[model samples]
Structures are given as structure tokens and as C-alpha cells.
Target: MSAAPRPADVVIIGAGQAGLAAGYHLRRAGADFVILDAQQVPGGAWQHAWPSLRLFSPAQYSSLPGRMMPIPAGGGYPDAAHVVAYLTDYEQRYRLPIIRPATVRTVRRAGARLAVESSAGTWHARIVVSATGTWWRPFVPHYPGMRDFRGEQVHTAGYRGPEPFHGRRVLVVGGGNSAAQILAELSQVAQTTWATLRPPRLLPDEVDGRALFDLATRRHRATLAGQHPVGAGGIADLGDIVAVAPVREARDRGALKAEPMFSRITTTGVAWADGSAAAFDAILWCTGFRPALAHLAPLRLRGPSGLIGTDGTRALAEPRLHLLGYGDWTGPASATLIGAGRTARQLAGEITAQL
Candidate 1:
């Protein structure tokens, strides 16, 4: 038999940047809260990122609330390992109450409190903050005969490096940063083809995450003030891609060109809508991810669009629940490091007021 549910005033799901930021605030407020993390280690999704991945912003801009991330020794954009080190330090610095390897199974109403069922145990809390990020839920769009493709197929989540595809023909799908970065690296050693639904919009060389975050902040403020914000689309209005060093290098090498998305997959490779086909040894899908809200399914809060309606961070159907770190829908730029910290500050203040 299972033990009785442990109690907390607040329960925050996930231990990534968003959850850590929330925990920092709630701790400062002296709230009785606990963070439940699915990962056994401190670094959340960063620990799983490809080894060569680098942040679009500098270390300082990608920091949590209490402490700024130290610039990497080499002084370029921090890589995945640097981020992992920073996160591990941040967790230890704050001494936040975190339960790891505690994969939450479901969150359901139990009297006045919500019961969080997890691999670790059950926790009953007055408020539940779902800060679970979307890294685990990779999305790969279906194409005709996709299942019939005999070539190796891999998604962004499973990708590690390009060495495996060396000297081979590889097809890369999607036009986002991941697709660009991965294609750039693979182009160094492999013959790569880029596929996109539309032509990619590359931001100016000077534009980066810091500029995008500032724009998002201004737009968020304008929205709060009930004004029609100029440049309301934030990063989308600027461009779809950031020309990081490697990407620019690839562009200079004439390897950054994109082709229209193929219509179907074949046993050997893929066929374009124009009746042309190409053979590839591997197909890398950098499509995207959806919100990781499977644990909240018991609440039935999602609508037909598979999204939970929210006023800021609070769920419309259940006031006791607040979703964080998913994306702009939860809070403007909330998925980013600084964005998550800013949103968590507001969310913790609101939750503190209730307590």
C-alpha cells in the first residue's frame, strides 16, 4: 500500500529554469512548497541537449533570479555543458526543496487541495504550478509513406552529433534554430539537404536573444496596459532564425540554402511535390515540440486545440493551477531563461498574496 500524501502549500512540477525560478520566489516568500522533477539531476533539459548546442544569448542574459550565470571561460555563448554546470550550481545555491526522479503521473482534485501523484509519492497542495517545459514532447509531422522510409530517422530530441552521419547524404527538416544549427554542423562532414514549409527568415547578424527578450518585455507591458502594442508579434516579426557564428559560417559556405518540404517519404528517401526524389542515408526531423501537459489530463482543462485556457498563468477552469514555462501563452517569452525568471516573479507574488 502507498503512504499517505505528503503536504505542501504549493507544488511546482518540473525542475528546469521555470520551476527553479518559481521555487526561488516561493522560497523568498517563506511558502511551504516543494519542487518535483522528473530528471534525477539538476540541469533540466540542458542535460539532454546536443553537446555542441550554444545559447543564443550571453551568460548574463540567460541567468536565473538570484544569481547571474558566469560567462564561459572561452567567452563565447555558453554551451550545453556550461549551462548544466550553472544550473547545478544554482540549485545548490538556493537550496530549494527538490524531489528528483519523481515523475508525476497525474494531478487531480482531492477536496480543497490538489493531489499530485508521482513516482516518488503523492503530494497534496493548495496550489499546483505546472512549470514542466516541452523538451520531452517532440513533434514530427507525418508525410505520406513516412513509416515506409528505410533510412535512419531521428528527431531533435534523439540527436547527439553529426559524426554518425559523416560522409553520408542527410535530409534535415524544419527551419527553426535547431534545424539551422544541426544542418550547419552536419554540413561540415555530411552532404545535407534543408527542407522547410516556407523560406526561413534569418535575423540580422547583430540580432540575438537579448534583443528579442527586450522586445517581448515591451510587448508584454503594453498588453498589461491595455494598449495595442506596436510590433506585437515579438520575435516572429523580426525573423525566424538567429545567425549564430556556426550558422553564419555555414551560410558563407553556401550550405544554408533551403528546399521546399518534400511531399512524401519513400523506402529509399523522399519525393518532392514536383515529382523529383532524392536518396538519403538519414533523415533528421527538427520539427518542434508541444506542451508537456500529459500529467494534467485528469483535470480535463484542455480545449479542442489541446491548450488550457489561462488568464496570465492561472488556468481558467481551475484557479488553483498555474501553468508556467510552456511559452508565450503562459507568459511572454516564458520559455526562455530570463523570461521564465520574470514570469515566475509575478506568479510567485500572486500566489503569495493568496497565501
Candidate 2:
């Protein structure tokens, strides 16, 4: 038999911003740990973002811990490719111990510690940092006769750009940022139709010079506590954020339409609950995503609204292996790249203390 696998002090899953941030702190503390990533390369979901898409937050807030993104003077929004490159540079510059392409299939509690099962095999660690952000699992709504529509159906994860639907009728579903961003861009080429489950409230992407970000960090908490309500309350209305950008220009071009969500699809195209069906060449589903924690075994976890519960309602619901990038713990910024650094730092502290 080969040598027995070495047990690490910590094992971090998903090498995104939070994972990398934890790695940064762990390395600085000289802790024995491994950062395991499922992707072939780094950058997490940034690698999967639409090629032309750029970060809404200016570079100042998008940097990782200890280092800042080398942003130019004027306000500039770097695209997805730029972000991926930056993460690569961040990994190299910081010498983060990242193991890539090793997808984690399961994480279970074995007595006191946690056992991480990945494609490579099993890893036993004193503590685990589940830095898997809550955006990968797309929320594709089920419909009656949805599969029979015959037209192509894809989610935001599958969307690359609008060039595919040039001069064609395309239905973009959902009312969130992904939907808005794709709608504003696709309207230039395709006859676009947007649908929502309900009329979503809209807020400015940035208010008082702040881009709404993750919900579990300090900045997010301060913004929430100071504000009348927390969050953009979900998706922002087109009219709210359209004041200072090209969104207004797109609306005037006759390519945009704001409406309630699509209920179903028909032979013609898609069917709305209000007895409306229109012709469409393709349908883009930007319906957002759900939290995926199915891999956790033995350790009980409770998920409501796609968020893991840390508080004790039923003692059995405790997550012996806790999750960090779940949602608004420390406020809105904790869940996003702009403020994930803070969450990662907190997680590192928790892990250090646990070990």
C-alpha cells in the first residue's frame, strides 16, 4: 500500500474569492491547509461569466485581501476575462496553495472531524471552509409542456453573448442583474422579451457610490443598518437604475419591454398566464440560481430560501462543517466579490480557533 494520506489542519472547498482569501490568511498564519477547487482554472464563477460582461463595482472594492486590483484612474469596469486574469495573478503573487480540477462530490462528518470526498479520493481534516459561493446552481423553473416548446432553452450559465440571436426574436426570462445585463445588451441585436415571476423592485446598482454586493461582511451590514431596508430587495426596476446609463438609450430603441414573468411556453413561443403567447426564435433563462448543498452527508444542514441556517432551531440542523459563502451573515457584501474578503477573513479566524 502507498503512504497514508496526511491529515491537514484545514481543508477549504471551492477556491474562489473566499477560498483564496482564507488561503491568504492561512498562509500568513503559517497554517497547514489545502485549497481545493473543482474548476480546471481559478476565478470560480468569473470564469463562467458572459465574455463581454464587466463587474458593476469599480475596481477599488473588487480586490482581494492584502492586495488591490491595479485599476486605472477613471471609473472603469473590467470584463469577465480581466477578472479571471486578475485572480490568476492574485494566486501567483500571493503563492496561494490551490489544487484545481479536483471536484468535491461529498463532505460528511465522521465523529468529531469532517471527511471531504472529492474525485481525487477522501481527505480528513480538523476543519473545513466551504467557500462555494451561492451562484453556480441555476434555478430553472418547471413549466407545463415546457419540454415540448421545441425552441432552444438555456440558462444564464449557458449564455455567452447576444450575437447568436441577431435579428431573431429572443425571450430572456428573470428580472435580476443577469437578466437586465443580457436584456440591455441583447436588445441591440434581437427582438428581446423579458418575463418575471412577479414585478421585482429595482434599486440603483450603486447608491451613494456603493455597488450592492455580498450580504455577509462588515460593509454590507453597515449599509443595511444605515438604510431603511436591506438589499436592493432583490432585482431593481429598470426605471430606478436607468437614470445615468445606456439602459435608457436601449429602452428608447424599441428593442426593450418590461413585463411580468413568463408562465409557460407554447407551440408559437412562450405562453404567459395572462393568455399571451408570442413568437420567439430562442429563449434565454436568466432565472438566477439556488444554493447547492446536496453533497453534505451525515452532517445535518437546513436550507431555506437557498441559505444555510447557522442558528439553532432544531439542534439536528447544525452544520458541523460550517459554510462561509452562504449569504448575508456579516450583510449584503459578504456574499459578493466586492466584500467577500471580509467573510473569508472571518472564516479563517473561526477555523483557526476551531483547530
Candidate 3:
């Protein structure tokens, strides 16, 4: 057998918004840690977002812990490229120790510590923070005869631009910001159909991320005070829709209407409950993603919901391991750029206390 590797104080997985936020805090507290990112380049999941995708919040509102994202010269929400550039700059500014293309394969108990198996090598970590968000795990619900459908299917994760879809019949599915934004753009190019489980909740045009965060904070406070709170759910619940320009334009153009989900996939098209069928050249699954927790599968800590049991960011079953930015279960609005900072600060404090 080989010699044992020296243990790190903490090992963070994914160099995205969450990992970067955690790094910001840990560095502030003078902690020794390393971040492992599967992507070779900077900007974690933002690198994969579609070209036209813009943040729901402004640059000032969508910043990490230490540094604020610089607003554009003109004025508007920063798009994916701008966010990616900000992330790259943030990493360089802080000089956070991050290993690139080091894909973590598994993590398991190693006596007093945990052994992290990755493409780079085995890392022994006293504490591990899994910040790998849901971009890699796009969820496409199964429908009857889906396997037999001859047309093309692509998840939003794989979607690049809409030029190739010009003149094609496409179905956009989901009720979130992504679905709305994509449906808006796609409608401009392709003959599109928007499908959702239920009609989407559109926030008032004036409502934005700041308003949403404030509302969520109120709900959280109310919940702690032993009161029943209204609108307690996903960041989407705060303002299920952001009235972006393209989406608003689509609405005005009568292209933003959404219908209930189809009953099944047919060889030639999708079938409705009313026994009607509509042919489509392709289906774009805007359905959201599950957490990328396969690396923790060996821990067997996941519940039926495929979520690790957690008290705040700390794993309930494995105290040494903390999960950040997977979803709301890890922290309030933890998945967004601004939200990651709060959770990262709290988790850093917890880890510091333990250390």
C-alpha cells in the first residue's frame, strides 16, 4: 500500500459561486483549505449557460462575499459572460488555491477524517464542503412513450443558441425564469410551445431579487417565531417570474402563454389528455436539476428526496461534511450568487469553531 496523504483543514468541491464564497470567508478567518473544480476553466456553471441568459438581479445585488460584481458601462443585469468574467476575476483577486479539472469521484469516512477520491488523487480532509451545484444534473421527467419518440430532445444545460432551431417546432417545458427566458427567445426564432405542470406565477414587474430576498427573510423570521408564513418555498416563490425585457416582449407578442404538460410522447409528437397530438421537431426540457451528490453516494446519507439530511449547511449524518449551494435545504436562497455569501459566512464560522 502507498503512504497516507497529508490531510487538508478543509476541502471544497466546485469552484462556483458557493465554493468561491466559502473561500472568501475561510481566507478571512485565516483557514487553510483547497477548492477542487471539475472544470478546467474559470466560471463554474455560468460557463454553460446560454449566450443570452442574464441574471435576475443587478450586478451589485448578485455579488459574492468580499467583492461586488462591477456593473456594465451602459446599465442592465449582467449576462452569463459577465458573471463568468466576474468569477474569474474574484478567484484571481483573492488568489484562492483551487485545483482545476480535478473531478471528485467519491468521499467516504476515513477514521477521524474523510478520504476524498478525485481524478487528481486522494485527499484526506478534516472537513469537506460539497458545493457542486445542480447544473450537471438536469432532470427530465419520464413520460409515456418517451423512449419511442423519434424527434430530438435537449436539456437546457446543453442549449447553446437558438439559431439552429429557426423555423422548427419546439416545446419548452418548465415554469421558472429559465423556462420563461428561453421560451421568449425561442419563440422569436422557432414556432414554440410552452408547457408547465401549472400556470406560472408572474411577479409584479417592480419586484426584483432584493424584494424577493427581503420577503424570504420575513418568512424565515416568521417561521422561527412560531407563525405560519405565506409564500414559503423556492426563490421562485419570492417572485416566480422576473419581468425581463425579452419575456415581457414575448408576452406582448402573445407568445408567452403556457399550457399544461402533455400526457405522453408519441412517435411523431406529444399527446394531450384530450387525445389531441401536436408534432414537434424537438423538445427542450427546461425542468430544473437535482443536486450533484453522486460523489457522496457512498455515504448513503441521502433521503428518498435524494437530498442529504442537513442542519443548515452541516450534514446531519456526517458532521464533518457540509453542503453549500445545492438548494434551499443548505441555506436560504443559497443557490444564487448573493445567497451563497450568507451561507458561506455561516458555514465558515461553524467550521472555524470546530477547528
Give me the candidate number with maximum lDDT.
1
**Candidate 1 or 3, higher TM-score?**
1
The TM-score of predicted model 2 comes to 0.85
Q: Would you estimate the TM-scores of all the predictions?
A: 0.98, 0.85, 0.96
Number of the top-ranking candidate, with TM-score as the measure: 1
Off by more than 4 A, model 1: none
Off by over 4 Å in 2: 1-3, 72-75, 199-249, 252-255, 303-306, 311-320, 329-331
The Cα local distance difference test for each model comes to: 0.93, 0.68, 0.89
Model 2 agreement with the true structure over 195-287: per-residue lDDT tens digits: 776654444434411434432233444554675444344324122332224444555674456777667778658777779778888888888
For residues 1-355, write the lDDT of model 1, one tens digit per residue.
9899999999999999999999999999999999999998999999999998978998988998999999999787888999899989998999999999999999999999999999999999999999999999999998999989898999999999999999999999999999999998999999899999999988999999999888888888888899988697777799999888898899998998999999999999999989999999999999999999999999999999999999899999999999999998899889999999999999999899877
Q: Is candidate 1 or candidate 2 better by lDDT?
A: 1
Q: What is the lDDT of residue 4 in candidate 3?
A: 60
Expressed as tens digits, the lDDT of each residue in 1-355 for candidate 3 is 7556757999999999999999999999999899999999999999999999988788999999889899976778889999999999999999999999999999999899999999888889999999999999999999999998899999999999899899999999889889999998999889999989988877777777777766666676677678886565645564578887777888888998989889999997799999888999999999999899999988889988778899889999999999999766888778989889988999999999988
Model 3, residue 86: displacement in angstroms? 0.1
